[model samples]
Target: MKIVITGGAGFIGSNLARALTEQPRVTQIRVLDNLSTGHKPNIAGLDVDFFEGDIQNAVLLDQVLRDADAVVHLAALPSVPRSLRDPLASHHANTTGTLQVLDAARRAGDLYVIAASSSSVYGANPNLPKHEDLTPAPMSPYAATKLATEAYLSAYHHSFGLPVLSFRLFNVYGPGQRADHAYAAVIPKWVSATLAGQPVTVHGDGTQTRDFTYVGTVCRVFTNALLRRIIEPRPVNLAFGTRKSLLDLIPEIEVATGRPAHREHRVPRVGDVSHSQADSTRLLALFPEVTPVPINEGIAATVDWFRASAVIAASS
Candidate 1:
């Protein structure tokens, strides 16, 4: 099978590319990334056909997507804070980019397209263990764009008969997830800060919770869905029902890195969800073989990667 992954040099996408390379059935892996956020080095040493370009370019998308058995759409302008600052950029990269990919896929013929949506879509819909049936109340422009992302996939599947799956990803963190960015995810940022003996920034007294999914588990599910040809028009929550608050996460990080975290509390950013947890019934029914990596274990792995990266950086 030949696979094309958009934004394939980014955290989850690069990890997914690595996973696809290990599969015996997968013959080719092609990666398309604009490098606005994704680093080219994330996909270094991997066997993939690399195309550095934006997904918004229809002509470029067509070239990369041609003759691909499947296309995994992972490209997006992520982060609620970033979107709050510039909503139109988020719309163009996420919503319009998704439309471009779907159109390119339709023209590509018999291709299975899978996309990454966010759990942020359940914004302002105060509910525990968010299910697929809940009406999306997107508080942030980022969430709205993600809602549109999955909605567009569903539309393509219904209207054009294109086989597609949209997974509502929770807090996905693991190795290759960079902490150098201003809008870095909590896990990577905290891990990096703790490793460097710096105060980890905690927004809103560190009480906000998230259903964090390991990048490996996410990659496995995406690989399985691609190989199995899973086609669900409705968005599937990709996270298991595990809730961990920011305070709950500190001790785990301390245990992993053998250093106590010095937390600097700050006001909560706008458009940030107070809490998020997924009701994984549909995800389990679809991908039962997926076993979630325990948070402690995942954190330990992340620490190990950071240590290795630090050593590499020092040597260089």
Candidate 2:
């Protein structure tokens, strides 16, 4: 079986591609990406077909989707701040790009399209352990686009018989992640700070909690979602089901890097949620056997990878 994974060189996409490469049934893994935020080094030495192009380009996206049995769409402009800065770009990439991907895959007669989603769709509802049933209150353009993408996936599934499964990922973090962007995810940024003996920026007193899921764990969930014969439109929450606050997680970072973080409390960014977790009961129900790897184990592995990858590690 052949598979096409968009954003295939990004952190989550690279992990998913590697997983598919090892699968006995998967003979070909085609990676379609623009390499905008994705580094070519991410997929280096991996045995797969890499196509460099934007998902918005229908002709290119169509070519990539043709002959692939499944499509895991992960390309997007991810970040609340970044989305706020360029709402139109975010919407175009997340919403319109998704439609194009699904259209391309549908034209190719592929039934499975596992689209990556975000927990930001929950917004600031003060809801604990967010369930798939919760009404989405997307606060930022990024979240709204994701929610829009989810809507399109559902519509395609029902109207055109496009088998699409949306996996709502919460706080995914791990190795090979980008830490250079202004709106980069917390894990990579914090790890970079702690490693450099710099103050870690904790927005909103660090009380904000999140389901900091390991990227490897999320990659597994994506694989499971791809392998499954999804018959209808079902948006599943892919998370660890455990919660961790930024304050409580600092000690773990310090322990991992052997350097305590000097935290700087900053004003909460707009469109940010106070606390959020996932009620992964429904997800576990679907895949009863798949258990998320412990957060600490993931953190340790991430820190070790950073230490190995960072050029200044020796000098530090």
lDDT of 1 by residue, 115-197 (tens): 99999999999988899999899999999999999999999989999999999999999999889988999999999999889
Per-residue lDDT over 1-316 for candidate 2, one digit per residue giving the tens place of the 0 to 100 score: 7889889998899988888887888889999889877877889889899999999999998788777898889999888999999999999888999999988988888548889888999996777779998988989999999999889999998888888889888999998876777888998999988988889998898988989999888877777766775544767898956898999999989888889888999999999988889998888887787888888888899998887887654676
Every candidate's lDDT? 0.95, 0.86
- For candidate 1, what is the lDDT? 0.95
Q: What TM-score goes with each of the models?
A: 0.99, 0.96
Question: Which segments of model 2 are wrong by more than 4 Å?
Answer: 311-316
Strongest candidate by TM-score: 1
lDDT of 1 at 117: 97
